[model samples]
Target: MPPVKKIVMWLVVIFLLYAIFTSPDSAADIFGSAWDVVANGVRNIGRFFDSLISRS
Candidate 1:
């Protein structure tokens, strides 16, 4: 990866670590919401492909 991208990634990692250690509840909530969003996106993509197949 590029240098700037690496630096930004490190900063995000540090922040997440701080959040996890200092306030675990908030961290869990944040991660849970992120996972929910990803799951929904994947489900939507599957539905879209299923619809296309049915139409053909």
Candidate 2:
């Protein structure tokens, strides 16, 4: 599991680095997509916690 996690992490890092280094447009797209994903994740987490707190 640890090895798999490490490999996945490295793959993501390498892909991001490649994207950033290869083309500015592609890098911008990648960054935008990543930002969207992170923002959505944070929103979801906040909603979940809020719901939990409200229920309690």
Each prediction's whole-model lDDT (CA): 0.97, 0.92
User: Which residues of candidate 1, in runs, are more than 4 Å off?
Assistant: none
TM-score of each: 0.87, 0.61
lDDT of 2 by residue, 1-56 (tens): 89999999999999878877889797898779999999999999999999999997
Candidate 1, pairs of clashing residues = none
Count clashing residue pairs per candidate.
0, 0
> lDDT by residue for model 1 over 1-56, one digit each (tens)?
69999999999999989999999999999999999999999999999999999999
Q: Kindly give the stretch of ten consecutive residues in candidate 1 with the minimal lDDT sum.
A: 1-10
Which ranges of candidate 2 are over 4 A from the true structure? 1-18
* Top candidate when judged by TM-score against the true structure: 1
Against the true structure, candidate 1 has what lDDT?
Answer: 0.97
Cα-based RMSD of candidate 1:
1.6
